[model samples]
Target: MPLEQIRPSHIHQYQNFLEKRELSSTTVRIYLTLIKVICLCINNSSYNLYFSMYSYKR
Candidate 1:
């Protein structure tokens, strides 16, 4: 899906969806951190940053 397709309410809805899946706050933070690190590392590289073990799929 495109980011343009996402709405402000979708952010809250995603949080609720994750909560319903029983993910802990620590896990959530870890995921966010991994996302941040991957983004920071991804500067016009062909490499897949998400190949790291810290990366998770929702």
Candidate 2:
């Protein structure tokens, strides 16, 4: 799906999918972190910014 159309539900679903694949917990966390960073970059946020993981609706 397009970035503009991405929602918190999608992220949650992706997390679930990754977990089902038996990825290590740490790896899943890193992937989610990277995803948050990418979303910030896509939104043109400053590199020094921060985001709360819970801000996204599961």
The best candidate in terms of lDDT? 2
The Cα local distance difference test for each model comes to: 0.63, 0.85
**Scored by Cα lDDT, where does model 1 land?**
0.63
Q: For residues 8-55, write the lDDT of model 2, one tens digit per residue.
A: 999999999999999999999999999998887778655434444435
lDDT of candidate 1 over 1-58, digit per residue (tens): 6645656586567667777789998876676566556555664244453455457768
Q: How well does candidate 2 score on lDDT at residue 25?
A: 99
Against the hidden reference, what TM-scores do the models get?
0.44, 0.73
lDDT of 1 at 21: 84
Task: Report model 1's TM-score to 2 decimal places.
Answer: 0.44
Give the best candidate by TM-score: 2
What TM-score does prediction 2 earn?
0.73
